[model samples]
Target: MKKMEDNTLVFIVDVKVNKHQIKQAVKKLYDIGVTKVNNLIRTDGEQKGYVQLTMMLWMLPMKLGSSKLSPIG
Candidate 1:
């Protein structure tokens, strides 16, 4: 399974993964609603793209489980 840090709405994702796919993935994985998703493609970089999501729709249990994620430096 993929691990994500708390306080982060952005994720480095696959080049082929589109907005719809990402939305579906997040929903399926977290079982929460998504308001919007912003994607930025970066070429010739170690990471392909950055995906931003809103935290407006979140599940209490899911958020609780994510507490272990350390803050990004």
Candidate 2:
């Protein structure tokens, strides 16, 4: 996950899973408190017959504050 200058959280995920599983995972994140979840892009995986997904999310300050430091620095 990455934090933008305006405080929006960005997540680029690549998962070798099906669409249903991806929806379930995103829903679970929302259920657990992730806000403004968005599916940025979805594409087939490099490997044959697999899938990949990309998501962008905006996180609450309280949530970001409690998390570990970002690795970007």
Candidate 3:
């Protein structure tokens, strides 16, 4: 994970996940507003998604340490 700016967060997710799907998932799961989603393909064949949230202060007190896959709209 990377912190690009005050309001942006970077995540490495499954390549099959799309930008819109990511935006929805982040919004629903975190209860935070997402302004945008950008994708970056790495040389080693990994997908990086940089999410622009409305505010970084809305992050939960606990860290998102696990990559659990659940049903997300």
Candidate 4:
């Protein structure tokens, strides 16, 4: 977690989503004003050999207001 100028803490989160949903997820983040996405990796799922996306995301502080947000639109 990194501290911001406002003395609030931010967390770096690793998320995995179905490959087909990557675009939607990233777009949703952008809409919420979060653009600090880190390393993005693609891998195969263990069970059905489906493509999966692993990306590093930034978690904003609670003071930002929208806590329960969904990246899928």
lDDT of each: 0.55, 0.41, 0.72, 0.34
Per-residue lDDT value at 48 in model 4: 22
Question: What are the models' TM-scores?
Answer: 0.59, 0.30, 0.70, 0.21
For model 1, how many clashes? 0
Best by TM-score: 3
Candidate 1 per-residue C-alpha lDDT over 1-73 given as tens digits, one digit per residue, 9 for 90 to 100: 1213432256678777888887788778766656656677776652332333355323334565764544344
Best prediction by lDDT: 3
Compose the digit string of candidate 3's lDDT tens values, residues 1-73.
4464456767787888999988998888777788899998889889988888776533433334444522221
The TM-score obtained by model 4 is: 0.21
Worst 10 residues of 3 by lDDT: 64-73
**lDDT tens string, model 4, 1-73?**
3323332223222445443354355446543333333333336422221112232323432433566643321
**TM-score-based ranking, best first?**
3, 1, 2, 4
Model 1 lDDT-worst window of ten: 1-10
Summarize candidate 2's per-residue lDDT along 17-70 as a digit string, tens digits.
444554466456644323334444445533221112233233432444654545
Q: After superposition, how far is residue 19 of candidate 3 from its true place, in Å?
A: 0.5
